[model samples]
Target chain A: MSGFLDILYFIVPISIAYAAPLIFTAIGGVFSERSGVINIGLEGLMVMGAFVGIVFNLFFVDTFGDWTPWVSILVAMLVSAIFSLMHAVASISFRADQVVSGVAINLLGIAIALFSVKMIYGKGQTDFIQEKIPRFNIPFLQDIPVIGPMFFKSVYGSSILAVAIAILAWFIIFKTPFGLRLRSVGEHPMAADTMGIKVNRIRYIAVIISGGLAGMGGAVYAQTMTNDFGHATINGQGFMALAAMIFGKWHPIGAMGAALFFGFAQALAISSSGIPFMQNVPSVFLYILPYALTIIALAGFIGKANGPKALGDPYIKGSR
Target chain B: MSNRLINVLVPVISIILGLLVGAVVMLVSGYDPIAGYIALWNGIFGDSYAIGETIRQISPYILAGLAVAFAFRTGLFNIGVEGQLIVGWFAAAYVGMAFELPKIIHLPLALLAAAAAGAIWGLIPGLLKATLKVHEVIVTIMMNYIALHLVNALIKVVAKGGFKTDKIQDTASLRSDFLSELTDFSTLHYGIFVALFMVFIMWFILERMKLGYELKSVGFNENAAQYAGMSVKKNIVMAMVISGAFAGLGGAMEALGTFGNMSTRAGFTGIGFDGIAVALLGANTPLGVVFGASLFGSLKYGANNMPNAANIPIEIVSIVIALIIFFVACGYIIRVGLQRIGKNKEAK
Candidate 1:
């Protein structure tokens, strides 16, 4: 009975662990698109972050020992932020087709990361880490019945941080003056410019923050969940996050809710055996669920979801 | 004179700016940008083998670029080229495995199957857009995922314990050992010839045919074309189908000529997405596509090879490509810079 209880305890926290990466990434997506730059390159940025995270963690684990995960997190943020600058320079400064530029960034990120992995390991996969993100039991709250064990015991601590960050993101996006200025820039850049808000600076800040958050998400994923980097590590997570952002109608809390739903779907896919004939369905269906759902969500079946008014439109100073 | 100079100089300036940014990144990482660039240059063009390999790599891009450029000309973003390529590959490979005939008959049959499959794959999004009034971008992106999963599942089911199809029959295979022999066993194949032929055909169709003109007109302004008695929906559908056909041919060549067999694990090679870059860089022209494909192909091939010779990561090349596209897309900076350079030259 105790063993069964323990097993039950793992379900929600593990699901939350899976949800962390998507939550952070989707929040990142919200920041970038809200500033009118569509970051299709999130996948690429995540991949780059994953690779550099693992590479840094691999080297620093012996030196920093248990703190390796923290170091890796910082490394990922820097790499991903640097990578996002390419998009900013292209889409914001250069005023390129945001979609095409995003595609280019995706290709660039994948190619570089894959090529480097090939060079380091002499193959596609990276070396497994000795020190990964350590799992922890939350101090007093872990003793609570049923839900406590699932949420606080044997859970990846990074997921808890993700939830806190999501709330913080909401505060930044809605409650603050800076957030208002940023939203104003996204809704009407010309009007914001006339009101003396630095449109370019806000965009730069948004894209950079987007990249940093996404980079941290990738690092968290590698260190906590997979504990290693490989060619397919980032896979479709970035796109899934994008879908979540859209499905949530670009709201941070809404995006988090969508991400958690996706995480539950993923967890359910593994745990539910009596889902009728779905037991016989291939795993690829689960793999494609978020993307498929995104399409359905975008089809207007979910009602008219609003996007940032200036989304995908390059800001011209005087243009109406 | 200034405009003429700027047209030639913009791409050059983009490339230079891209390289400069790449250099800073390299420097930050404690690597010599000069050494890395030289190695990349040598890897891409140092020898006959490298040149042949680059050309071979460019072959698929030529077709994919044309596919994208065609759709773009009609003002339709056929993002489903990735899916079209996958289905076309499966169809062509299935035909190649199923048939046994004289090489002359079998090859054309296989190629036709690929083209038809691509067109049909393309038609789904077209039909949806035409009938349901859905956006092509969303449909096409969805189709990419669907095609990827479907192909993977199909491969697992059909392989019957194998990961790939039975080796394609000799008659259906587009082996290029003859061309390889002429090039001293370099990777270059007869696919280059095929790509060139397709380019010529694309040019002839777009520039000389009334159907092509109608398609272009529809793309430029659907309402105007509708007023001129052109069927906007039909042209949009046809444009997607034709564009998908080109992408399908790209898959056929890659499978038959390069790999000589189809693996289920190989779905969309991402060349379709890259085709967007090629089309943009090429200005959506058939001949321009060849040059764009060659440049990007070399970058891809070179970037792949760079990590081996230099410590720099291959992703640096992608960063450079993105920067180049950004500069091209903006055009404003390049335009101002060129005018300044021209004014200075006149002063001199």
Candidate 2:
């Protein structure tokens, strides 16, 4: 029984912490992809967010006190949303190939961030932040017999916020009129345009929203996990979130599930040394498991994970 | 203006604009743009040593650019070039270390091993795309991480838990003593010949072969290709295989010429990612890729001098490259701006 409790204590917080960032980012991917703009630049946008978040926290830790991380996250989201305008202007207004533009975004994002870091800090990376987002147990839920200890104990506020946002995202995407317009534009922009809906406007908003959420996700990860910003802080997490977005078939709740699964895989890989039975297994196997599993999941096990019909196609004014 | 002139003009304009923006960024950050540019120029062509090293650095970029350009020409995006390159690096290193043969046999055998490894890596996503209708982009992205971790593990195993493998035997090396002597002992090697040959091969296949027609048609439209009695799946797989081989040869360039050994990477080397920009700047053409690779290689190699000479970060080059890609993607804007300028000049 103690062994089970020990495993729970080890696995629960780690997995949730890992999953929270992905959940936010994957849901962001869903919004953009569903609105017909392929956002391969999420990684770049996340990098910008992580950079901004760390810079803000380091500069204003005393002023914001305990609220530093949260404020930094908000600042990151705003900055990233503005940064994504470059992608929207290129891909949407200029009718650029979305993927190419996205690739440029990724490159520009990292280049600008690192260049600024070097200029400001006189180094490759920033100083570690003293304050981080705090984690705590729920008031009454931690007292429950078995479930409480596994789920509610030692939980990050950001983790809970991520799950709550996922639910809210589901409602927004599936239930709201704005969601209907967004999906319609993604499915058939021509049809949406005929219905008097502004296709480019919707796509711009969607991309901005995606940028904001991904930025928030990056900040959360930086503040809670790394406690600082560097080149490696947000490495490939955006891509993993992208995989989760696809693996979840672009559904918000489904993306959350996939993120949690990937998070579990990541947590297992990181914590394998502590587990007695799994100690003999090669770390490589654990490391590659999530990626290999994503490939397997995509190759017919999921039965055609079709994206929005017009996902990569830019909507022109009149040309079919 | 002639179509060919316009084609040349667009890239030239983009490059100039990219550099201008980079200059502006430097100025905004309180750095001397003139000094930075001067430092950059000196770094690239200061002496024979810098020239030789820059050319050597360009060799792999040429192949990596070809890999991306070939895929783009065939309507595929092989984002897995990084993964293919990784596996190829391992394969070449493995053969070079484990085998004993004459120089001629050893070098080609190592190159072939690298190509085969990259081909296999590319084949997985191609097969999945053809058979299961899975998107190649996500699959290739996944393959990258798989290759990174898998190769790292394999390196540890082969090196007895060390980060790098033993250096290759002399027989397998691409080092050219005469070239090195001419360039003041720079790391220039015979890999440039291999890169040039592959460029020619890409040109011949894409522009002069029947198979190229099929591949291009398949890329243009799978349904149309299928209707024309061509096997879409076969062409897709074949395109990826050929592209992967080019990328793998890029890895061999590093293993056999530049580094002479493979080490576990903390993260991606950014060579493959940079290949995307190279391909774009080159307009996805064979000869264009060479020029693009040269420009990129020069900038990247010269960037090392920025810290000491001008107090600028090496990432400034990356920013310039990114801006170039952005301008290329938004060529419509440039074209419109140019046309407006032309009209205004006529009125004046």
Candidate 3:
């Protein structure tokens, strides 16, 4: 029992760090998809965010020092919003296939990042980031016995911000006029249009917002998990976030919970050797456990779940 | 414009625009676009060796493209082709090593093993899509990561941390010394013939067969096909299985002909993802996929040498590919532009 407590102490903090990015990106998916535009380009958008965030941090770290991470997140978000406009125009305005457009963005995002790195350094890689986001514990709460040390110790600001943002997102989606219009567009665009709501306009904004949040998610992963931006920095974290969104039934709070579950699985996989008995499991099995779980989880959602009714269909005016 | 002209012109225009944007990116980065393109051309077509390499590269692309195109014709999106291809790749390699049969028997047997393996992998998602109505796009993407990691684990177990497996027996190998000599010592093999044969099969099935007509009708309208007494569920599963067979052939070509060995991959080969673009570019036809696959193959083959020759990033080739696909997706915009020009001509 003592041994198990020690393992939990290590796993809890690490899982939250992993969960922060997934939660943010999953929330983005909920927004775009709930607005009737499925943003499969989250992976690409996240990569861009990771790239810009690190590059911006490197450029300004000397001048801004420790405060660079927060500013870089904002920069990445802005850049990502602009980058996703291409998807918005292609899918919504030019009437392109949403999946195809998303794939295009994915390809472009990675290529552009790689090409820029090559152009800047005349090589396939960039320099590693030296300054990282600082971890902190709550002041007096740190003295509180078991719950404090397990949860609040060595915490990332990004994780706390993620929970807050999720709460804010839940409120915006469930309790606000803007979210009502957004849901209406996703459910029935013609019905929403007749009621003086602009479907295309809402979709464009929703996609941009999704892009911005996913970018920040990428930034968070780079800052906390990898501490560097490279080809492999983001890996498949964005797709995992998408799986969380689906698993959560497109609800913000639900997605956050799903993200936490995936993060715990990931933390378990990486740290299994440190815990007794788990060392017997093959490392390869652990590596694949999260992805296999994601597939099973999505399959589980099949009978009960329904995505936005107008999802994947472009809105056309006066075409009842 | 005639339908045939539009069909040809759309891809041509898309390619030109893709190249133009690639050139602009190069210029903005202070590189000479003309020099880079010249290097690209020379890298792919300058010598018999380059030509052979390009054709060698084209082999798997053709089959993968067909896999995607075939599924599209059945109104099913089969993004799981990557997973199927990897499973087939490993299956072919496994059979080649495990068996000790006659040359003729072993080669065909390995290829069959690959196709069967891919077909089974594809069947899972197809059943889910048909019965549960779960989207293939999400299912396949998740499956892809699972396939990669599973293969990685298996390869480690089989090879005992070797990271790469040994070359297959000579009987299972597709490499032909005669074909390589004919191409002046390049990696070209008999896989090209096999790929072309598959294309011919695709064309014959879709254009000439009874079952092909039913598949096409089903693809065009699922409800209509159902009302007309066709089994949508059966057709969906069949389409995915057949599509997986083609992607499996692509994997076999890579395992037997090109590499002749299996190695742990860091990520997907990107051949399957690129196949989606190839299918769209080909207008989802076998003959069109041939054209798209060839173009893509040449670009990829050339990209390997572009960085050394012109001081340009090899990623430019992929950027060009993405741009081409984007332009194809936005084909309507170009069509509208052309229609406006035609109207002005009429006004004049």
Per-chain TM-score (chain B), model 2 = 0.96
For model 3, residues A15-66, the per-residue Cα lDDT tens digits are: 8999999999999999999998888889989999999988888899998888
RMSD versus native structure for model 3: 1.5
Q: lDDT value for candidate 1?
A: 0.80
Q: Write the per-residue lDDT of candidate 1 for residues A1-320, one digit (tens) a residue.
A: 77566555645776787788889889999999887788877877887788888999998888998888888888898989998998898788777777777777777787677656765676768988888887889988888888777788877767888889899999999999999998999998998999999999999999999898888888888877777887668766777788788888888998999898888767656765644445676677876687677766766667755679898888877777
lDDT of 2 by residue, B226-342 (tens): 999999888889999998899899999999888888999877878888888888889899999999999999999988889899989989999999999888988877777777776
Residue B9, model 1: lDDT of 74
Best by lDDT: 2
Off by over 4 Å in 2: B339-348
TM per prediction: 0.88, 0.98, 0.97
Instruction: Give one digit per residue, the lDDT tens place, for model 1 in B1-348.
Output: 457667667766776887898788778667788889988898788877787778888988898999999989998888778888887777778788878989999988988888898888788778767765666775677777777777777666667757777767888876777767766677677777888898998898899999899989998899999999999999889988999899888888776777766776533487888787778778788987988898888987877667778867776787677666666666666777678877898999
Could you report the DockQ of all the candidates, in the order they appear?
0.39, 0.78, 0.75
What is candidate 1's TM-score against the reference?
0.88
Clashing pairs in 3: none
